[model samples]
Target: MSQTGYQSFEELIVWKKARELKNELFQLGKAFPPEEKYRLTDQLIRSSRSINAQIAEGHGKRTNKDKIKYCTQARGSISETINHLIDAFDCGYISTEQLKRYRIRFDELEKILSGYIKYLRSLPGD
Candidate 1:
Protein backbone atom coordinates (compact mmCIF):
# COMPACT_ATOMS: atom_id res chain seq x y z
CA MET A 1 0.00 0.00 0.00
CA SER A 2 1.08 3.57 -0.59
CA GLN A 3 1.77 6.02 2.23
CA THR A 4 -1.37 7.84 1.17
CA GLY A 5 -3.50 4.70 1.91
CA TYR A 6 -4.04 3.93 -1.74
CA GLN A 7 -3.47 0.41 -3.09
CA SER A 8 -2.45 1.64 -6.50
CA PHE A 9 -1.77 4.91 -8.26
CA GLU A 10 -4.94 4.24 -10.25
CA GLU A 11 -6.91 4.69 -7.04
CA LEU A 12 -5.53 8.16 -6.43
CA ILE A 13 -7.76 11.04 -7.49
CA VAL A 14 -4.80 13.07 -8.66
CA TRP A 15 -3.58 10.29 -10.92
CA LYS A 16 -7.07 9.85 -12.30
CA LYS A 17 -7.27 13.51 -13.13
CA ALA A 18 -3.88 13.37 -14.77
CA ARG A 19 -4.99 10.36 -16.77
CA GLU A 20 -8.05 12.25 -17.95
CA LEU A 21 -5.95 15.21 -18.98
CA LYS A 22 -3.48 12.97 -20.76
CA ASN A 23 -6.25 11.27 -22.67
CA GLU A 24 -7.77 14.56 -23.70
CA LEU A 25 -4.39 15.82 -24.83
CA PHE A 26 -3.80 12.66 -26.85
CA GLN A 27 -7.08 13.21 -28.66
CA LEU A 28 -6.17 16.80 -29.32
CA GLY A 29 -2.81 15.78 -30.70
CA LYS A 30 -4.54 13.65 -33.27
CA ALA A 31 -5.91 16.84 -34.78
CA PHE A 32 -2.54 18.45 -35.28
CA PRO A 33 -1.10 18.97 -38.76
CA PRO A 34 0.68 16.06 -40.37
CA GLU A 35 3.88 18.05 -40.63
CA GLU A 36 3.97 18.29 -36.83
CA LYS A 37 3.89 14.52 -36.41
CA TYR A 38 7.53 14.45 -35.24
CA ARG A 39 7.58 17.77 -33.47
CA LEU A 40 4.89 19.51 -31.42
CA THR A 41 2.48 16.58 -31.43
CA ASP A 42 5.10 14.11 -30.23
CA GLN A 43 6.39 16.38 -27.48
CA LEU A 44 2.92 17.31 -26.30
CA ILE A 45 1.78 13.70 -26.01
CA ARG A 46 4.99 12.59 -24.30
CA SER A 47 4.92 15.28 -21.64
CA SER A 48 1.22 14.89 -20.91
CA ARG A 49 1.62 11.14 -20.52
CA SER A 50 4.63 11.61 -18.30
CA ILE A 51 2.49 13.32 -15.66
CA ASN A 52 0.53 10.17 -14.91
CA ALA A 53 3.50 7.85 -15.36
CA GLN A 54 5.54 9.83 -12.87
CA ILE A 55 2.74 9.73 -10.33
CA ALA A 56 2.42 5.99 -10.69
CA GLU A 57 6.17 5.49 -10.38
CA GLY A 58 6.26 7.71 -7.34
CA HIS A 59 3.53 5.76 -5.62
CA GLY A 60 5.49 2.56 -6.10
CA LYS A 61 8.61 3.90 -4.42
CA ARG A 62 9.72 2.49 -1.05
CA THR A 63 10.62 5.80 0.54
CA ASN A 64 8.72 9.01 1.15
CA LYS A 65 11.61 11.03 -0.22
CA ASP A 66 11.60 9.03 -3.43
CA LYS A 67 7.84 9.45 -3.69
CA ILE A 68 8.13 13.19 -3.21
CA LYS A 69 10.88 13.34 -5.79
CA TYR A 70 8.77 11.57 -8.37
CA CYS A 71 5.74 13.71 -7.62
CA THR A 72 7.89 16.78 -8.09
CA GLN A 73 8.92 15.36 -11.44
CA ALA A 74 5.26 14.90 -12.25
CA ARG A 75 4.67 18.53 -11.35
CA GLY A 76 7.43 19.53 -13.72
CA SER A 77 5.80 17.44 -16.45
CA ILE A 78 2.61 19.43 -15.93
CA SER A 79 4.47 22.64 -16.64
CA GLU A 80 6.11 21.08 -19.67
CA THR A 81 2.74 20.00 -20.99
CA ILE A 82 1.37 23.51 -20.53
CA ASN A 83 4.29 24.92 -22.47
CA HIS A 84 3.53 22.56 -25.34
CA LEU A 85 -0.11 23.62 -25.23
CA ILE A 86 0.97 27.24 -25.55
CA ASP A 87 3.17 26.28 -28.47
CA ALA A 88 0.22 24.61 -30.13
CA PHE A 89 -1.82 27.77 -29.69
CA ASP A 90 0.95 29.97 -31.08
CA CYS A 91 1.26 27.72 -34.11
CA GLY A 92 -2.50 28.01 -34.72
CA TYR A 93 -3.05 24.30 -34.06
CA ILE A 94 -5.46 25.19 -31.30
CA SER A 95 -7.71 28.17 -30.57
CA THR A 96 -7.56 30.62 -27.65
CA GLU A 97 -10.58 28.95 -26.09
CA GLN A 98 -8.96 25.52 -26.37
CA LEU A 99 -5.80 26.77 -24.74
CA LYS A 100 -7.79 28.40 -21.94
CA ARG A 101 -9.73 25.21 -21.29
CA TYR A 102 -6.55 23.13 -21.10
CA ARG A 103 -4.91 25.66 -18.82
CA ILE A 104 -7.83 25.36 -16.41
CA ARG A 105 -7.58 21.58 -16.42
CA PHE A 106 -3.80 21.66 -15.93
CA ASP A 107 -4.21 24.13 -13.07
CA GLU A 108 -6.67 21.86 -11.32
CA LEU A 109 -4.41 18.83 -11.84
CA GLU A 110 -1.41 20.69 -10.46
CA LYS A 111 -3.32 21.71 -7.35
CA ILE A 112 -4.44 18.16 -6.71
CA LEU A 113 -0.94 16.79 -7.33
CA SER A 114 0.49 19.35 -4.93
CA GLY A 115 -1.98 18.32 -2.28
CA TYR A 116 -0.99 14.69 -2.74
CA ILE A 117 2.64 15.63 -2.29
CA LYS A 118 1.75 17.50 0.88
CA TYR A 119 -0.08 14.47 2.17
CA LEU A 120 2.92 12.27 1.45
CA ARG A 121 5.15 14.69 3.32
CA SER A 122 2.91 14.47 6.37
CA LEU A 123 3.43 10.73 6.59
CA PRO A 124 5.79 9.38 9.30
CA GLY A 125 8.67 8.05 7.24
CA ASP A 126 11.74 8.91 5.19
Candidate 2:
Protein backbone atom coordinates (compact mmCIF):
# COMPACT_ATOMS: atom_id res chain seq x y z
CA MET A 1 0.00 0.00 0.00
CA SER A 2 2.92 2.31 0.70
CA GLN A 3 6.24 2.78 -1.09
CA THR A 4 7.93 0.40 1.36
CA GLY A 5 5.26 -2.31 0.78
CA TYR A 6 4.36 -2.15 4.44
CA GLN A 7 0.72 -1.59 5.45
CA SER A 8 1.74 0.90 8.10
CA PHE A 9 4.76 2.46 9.71
CA GLU A 10 3.86 0.37 12.76
CA GLU A 11 4.88 -2.65 10.69
CA LEU A 12 8.38 -1.31 10.08
CA ILE A 13 11.15 -2.77 12.22
CA VAL A 14 12.79 0.63 12.62
CA TRP A 15 9.59 2.19 13.85
CA LYS A 16 9.00 -0.67 16.26
CA LYS A 17 12.50 -0.28 17.66
CA ALA A 18 11.96 3.46 17.98
CA ARG A 19 8.71 2.84 19.82
CA GLU A 20 10.47 0.51 22.23
CA LEU A 21 13.11 3.14 22.94
CA LYS A 22 10.42 5.80 23.42
CA ASN A 23 8.61 3.66 25.95
CA GLU A 24 11.81 2.97 27.81
CA LEU A 25 12.63 6.68 27.93
CA PHE A 26 9.13 7.47 29.16
CA GLN A 27 9.60 5.07 32.05
CA LEU A 28 12.98 6.58 32.79
CA GLY A 29 11.47 10.05 32.84
CA LYS A 30 9.05 9.08 35.60
CA ALA A 31 11.90 8.83 38.06
CA PHE A 32 13.13 12.35 37.43
CA PRO A 33 12.76 14.88 40.25
CA PRO A 34 9.50 16.76 40.44
CA GLU A 35 11.47 19.95 39.97
CA GLU A 36 12.39 18.71 36.50
CA LYS A 37 8.84 17.72 35.62
CA TYR A 38 8.52 20.68 33.25
CA ARG A 39 12.05 20.62 31.90
CA LEU A 40 14.31 17.63 31.18
CA THR A 41 11.62 15.00 31.62
CA ASP A 42 9.30 16.77 29.20
CA GLN A 43 12.02 17.33 26.62
CA LEU A 44 13.20 13.71 26.86
CA ILE A 45 9.72 12.26 26.44
CA ARG A 46 8.82 14.58 23.53
CA SER A 47 12.02 13.94 21.56
CA SER A 48 11.80 10.18 22.02
CA ARG A 49 8.18 10.18 20.85
CA SER A 50 9.08 12.34 17.83
CA ILE A 51 11.22 9.56 16.34
CA ASN A 52 8.22 7.26 15.90
CA ALA A 53 5.87 10.09 15.05
CA GLN A 54 8.06 11.20 12.18
CA ILE A 55 8.35 7.65 10.90
CA ALA A 56 4.61 7.15 10.93
CA GLU A 57 4.02 10.47 9.24
CA GLY A 58 6.64 9.73 6.60
CA HIS A 59 5.12 6.33 5.88
CA GLY A 60 1.87 8.02 4.94
CA LYS A 61 3.53 10.22 2.36
CA ARG A 62 2.90 9.42 -1.31
CA THR A 63 6.48 9.99 -2.47
CA ASN A 64 9.71 8.28 -1.51
CA LYS A 65 11.32 11.72 -1.32
CA ASP A 66 8.80 12.85 1.30
CA LYS A 67 9.29 9.65 3.23
CA ILE A 68 13.05 10.15 3.26
CA LYS A 69 12.57 13.69 4.55
CA TYR A 70 10.49 12.48 7.46
CA CYS A 71 12.97 9.71 8.25
CA THR A 72 15.73 12.33 8.28
CA GLN A 73 13.68 14.31 10.78
CA ALA A 74 13.33 11.18 12.87
CA ARG A 75 17.10 10.89 12.86
CA GLY A 76 17.30 14.45 14.14
CA SER A 77 14.93 13.50 16.93
CA ILE A 78 17.25 10.64 17.80
CA SER A 79 20.13 13.05 18.28
CA GLU A 80 17.98 15.37 20.40
CA THR A 81 16.88 12.44 22.56
CA ILE A 82 20.49 11.36 23.12
CA ASN A 83 21.44 14.88 24.13
CA HIS A 84 18.63 14.89 26.68
CA LEU A 85 19.85 11.56 27.99
CA ILE A 86 23.28 13.09 28.46
CA ASP A 87 21.72 15.96 30.37
CA ALA A 88 19.93 13.48 32.60
CA PHE A 89 23.24 11.78 33.27
CA ASP A 90 24.94 15.09 34.12
CA CYS A 91 22.11 15.89 36.50
CA GLY A 92 22.52 12.51 38.19
CA TYR A 93 19.04 11.38 37.17
CA ILE A 94 20.51 8.40 35.37
CA SER A 95 23.64 6.30 35.96
CA THR A 96 26.52 6.04 33.51
CA GLU A 97 25.48 2.45 32.79
CA GLN A 98 21.96 3.56 31.99
CA LEU A 99 23.29 6.31 29.73
CA LYS A 100 25.57 3.89 27.90
CA ARG A 101 22.74 1.41 27.44
CA TYR A 102 20.52 4.11 25.92
CA ARG A 103 23.36 5.34 23.73
CA ILE A 104 23.85 1.87 22.26
CA ARG A 105 20.17 1.42 21.59
CA PHE A 106 19.99 4.83 19.92
CA ASP A 107 23.06 4.02 17.84
CA GLU A 108 21.36 0.91 16.53
CA LEU A 109 18.23 2.88 15.75
CA GLU A 110 20.24 5.47 13.85
CA LYS A 111 21.88 2.79 11.74
CA ILE A 112 18.52 1.19 10.97
CA LEU A 113 17.06 4.57 10.03
CA SER A 114 20.01 5.26 7.77
CA GLY A 115 19.42 1.96 6.06
CA TYR A 116 15.79 2.81 5.53
CA ILE A 117 16.78 6.14 4.01
CA LYS A 118 19.21 4.39 1.69
CA TYR A 119 16.51 2.02 0.58
CA LEU A 120 14.19 4.92 -0.13
CA ARG A 121 16.83 6.64 -2.17
CA SER A 122 17.13 3.50 -4.32
CA LEU A 123 13.49 3.62 -5.26
CA PRO A 124 12.26 5.20 -8.52
CA GLY A 125 10.88 8.73 -8.70
CA ASP A 126 7.68 9.80 -6.95
Candidate 3:
Protein backbone atom coordinates (compact mmCIF):
# COMPACT_ATOMS: atom_id res chain seq x y z
CA MET A 1 0.00 0.00 0.00
CA SER A 2 1.10 3.53 -0.73
CA GLN A 3 2.04 5.85 2.12
CA THR A 4 0.71 8.96 0.44
CA GLY A 5 -1.81 9.48 3.22
CA TYR A 6 -2.66 6.53 5.44
CA GLN A 7 -3.49 4.25 2.56
CA SER A 8 -4.89 1.65 4.95
CA PHE A 9 -6.59 1.48 8.31
CA GLU A 10 -3.46 -0.18 9.75
CA GLU A 11 -1.69 3.13 9.17
CA LEU A 12 -4.03 4.83 11.64
CA ILE A 13 -2.64 5.70 15.07
CA VAL A 14 -5.95 4.96 16.77
CA TRP A 15 -6.04 1.48 15.24
CA LYS A 16 -2.49 0.83 16.44
CA LYS A 17 -3.39 1.95 19.94
CA ALA A 18 -6.57 -0.13 19.82
CA ARG A 19 -4.48 -3.14 18.75
CA GLU A 20 -2.17 -2.54 21.71
CA LEU A 21 -5.19 -2.29 23.95
CA LYS A 22 -6.38 -5.66 22.62
CA ASN A 23 -3.04 -7.25 23.47
CA GLU A 24 -3.07 -5.82 26.96
CA LEU A 25 -6.64 -7.01 27.33
CA PHE A 26 -5.60 -10.53 26.36
CA GLN A 27 -2.84 -10.46 28.95
CA LEU A 28 -5.25 -9.16 31.56
CA GLY A 29 -7.84 -11.82 30.78
CA LYS A 30 -5.20 -14.53 30.86
CA ALA A 31 -4.72 -13.82 34.54
CA PHE A 32 -8.30 -14.67 35.34
CA PRO A 33 -9.25 -18.10 36.73
CA PRO A 34 -10.39 -20.89 34.44
CA GLU A 35 -14.04 -20.33 35.28
CA GLU A 36 -14.00 -16.92 33.59
CA LYS A 37 -12.34 -18.26 30.46
CA TYR A 38 -15.67 -18.34 28.59
CA ARG A 39 -17.46 -15.54 30.31
CA LEU A 40 -15.84 -12.24 31.32
CA THR A 41 -12.58 -13.20 29.65
CA ASP A 42 -14.24 -13.93 26.34
CA GLN A 43 -16.22 -10.68 26.42
CA LEU A 44 -13.10 -8.67 27.19
CA ILE A 45 -11.18 -10.24 24.35
CA ARG A 46 -14.01 -9.85 21.87
CA SER A 47 -14.78 -6.24 22.73
CA SER A 48 -11.17 -5.13 22.66
CA ARG A 49 -10.63 -6.81 19.33
CA SER A 50 -13.82 -5.28 17.96
CA ILE A 51 -12.42 -1.79 18.33
CA ASN A 52 -9.86 -2.36 15.60
CA ALA A 53 -11.99 -4.61 13.46
CA GLN A 54 -14.75 -2.04 13.25
CA ILE A 55 -12.32 0.74 12.54
CA ALA A 56 -10.81 -1.25 9.68
CA GLU A 57 -14.27 -1.93 8.32
CA GLY A 58 -15.13 1.74 8.52
CA HIS A 59 -12.02 2.73 6.62
CA GLY A 60 -13.01 0.46 3.76
CA LYS A 61 -16.47 2.01 3.50
CA ARG A 62 -17.32 4.27 0.55
CA THR A 63 -19.12 7.06 2.37
CA ASN A 64 -18.47 9.40 5.28
CA LYS A 65 -21.75 8.41 6.91
CA ASP A 66 -20.86 4.74 6.64
CA LYS A 67 -17.45 5.41 8.10
CA ILE A 68 -19.01 7.38 10.93
CA LYS A 69 -21.43 4.54 11.66
CA TYR A 70 -18.66 1.95 11.90
CA CYS A 71 -16.36 4.23 13.89
CA THR A 72 -19.24 4.76 16.27
CA GLN A 73 -19.35 0.99 16.68
CA ALA A 74 -15.62 1.06 17.39
CA ARG A 75 -16.23 3.71 20.02
CA GLY A 76 -18.95 1.58 21.58
CA SER A 77 -16.59 -1.41 21.63
CA ILE A 78 -13.99 0.68 23.39
CA SER A 79 -16.56 1.54 26.03
CA GLU A 80 -17.46 -2.14 26.33
CA THR A 81 -13.82 -3.00 26.90
CA ILE A 82 -13.60 -0.34 29.60
CA ASN A 83 -16.66 -1.73 31.34
CA HIS A 84 -15.26 -5.27 31.29
CA LEU A 85 -11.95 -4.04 32.68
CA ILE A 86 -13.76 -2.28 35.49
CA ASP A 87 -15.57 -5.51 36.25
CA ALA A 88 -12.26 -7.34 36.26
CA PHE A 89 -10.88 -4.91 38.81
CA ASP A 90 -14.01 -5.06 40.92
CA CYS A 91 -13.84 -8.84 40.92
CA GLY A 92 -10.20 -8.69 42.04
CA TYR A 93 -8.84 -10.28 38.90
CA ILE A 94 -6.61 -7.31 38.22
CA SER A 95 -4.84 -4.72 40.36
CA THR A 96 -6.10 -1.16 40.73
CA GLU A 97 -2.87 0.03 39.18
CA GLN A 98 -3.43 -2.22 36.19
CA LEU A 99 -6.94 -0.87 35.76
CA LYS A 100 -5.66 2.68 35.88
CA ARG A 101 -3.06 2.00 33.21
CA TYR A 102 -5.58 0.29 30.95
CA ARG A 103 -8.06 3.10 31.51
CA ILE A 104 -5.51 5.67 30.42
CA ARG A 105 -4.80 3.74 27.23
CA PHE A 106 -8.49 3.33 26.38
CA ASP A 107 -9.18 6.96 27.23
CA GLU A 108 -6.58 8.05 24.71
CA LEU A 109 -8.02 5.69 22.13
CA GLU A 110 -11.52 7.09 22.78
CA LYS A 111 -10.39 10.67 22.31
CA ILE A 112 -8.64 9.87 19.05
CA LEU A 113 -11.57 7.86 17.77
CA SER A 114 -13.94 10.67 18.65
CA GLY A 115 -11.81 13.21 16.83
CA TYR A 116 -11.59 10.98 13.77
CA ILE A 117 -15.36 10.62 13.73
CA LYS A 118 -15.74 14.35 13.93
CA TYR A 119 -13.40 14.82 11.01
CA LEU A 120 -15.33 12.31 9.00
CA ARG A 121 -18.59 14.06 9.75
CA SER A 122 -17.12 17.37 8.64
CA LEU A 123 -16.15 16.05 5.24
CA PRO A 124 -17.68 17.70 2.20
CA GLY A 125 -21.04 16.31 0.98
CA ASP A 126 -21.21 14.24 4.15
| Best model number under lDDT | 2
lDDT of 3 by residue, 1-126 (tens): 586654789988889999988997898788899999999999999999999999999999999999999999999998999999899999999899988998888898999999999899889974
* Order by lDDT, highest first: 2, 1, 3
**Which is the winner by lDDT between candidate 2 and candidate 3?**
2
Best of the two (2, 3) by TM-score: 2
lDDT (0 to 1) per candidate: 0.95, 0.96, 0.92
Model 1 misplaced regions, further than 4 Å: 1-6
lDDT of 3: 0.92
**lDDT tens digits, residue span 26-64, model 2:** 999999999999999999999999999999999999999
Candidate 2 — worst ten consecutive residues by lDDT sum? 1-10
Over 4 Å off, model 3 = 1-6
The local lDDT score (0 to 100) that residue 87 gets in candidate 3 is 95
Model 2 ranges with Cα > 4 A deviation: 1-6
| TM-score of every prediction relative to native | 0.94, 0.95, 0.94
Candidate with maximal TM-score: 2
Of 1 and 3, the candidate ranking higher by TM-score: 1
Candidate 2's error at 78, in angstroms? Answer: 0.1
lDDT by residue (tens digit), candidate 1, 72-92: 999999999999999999999
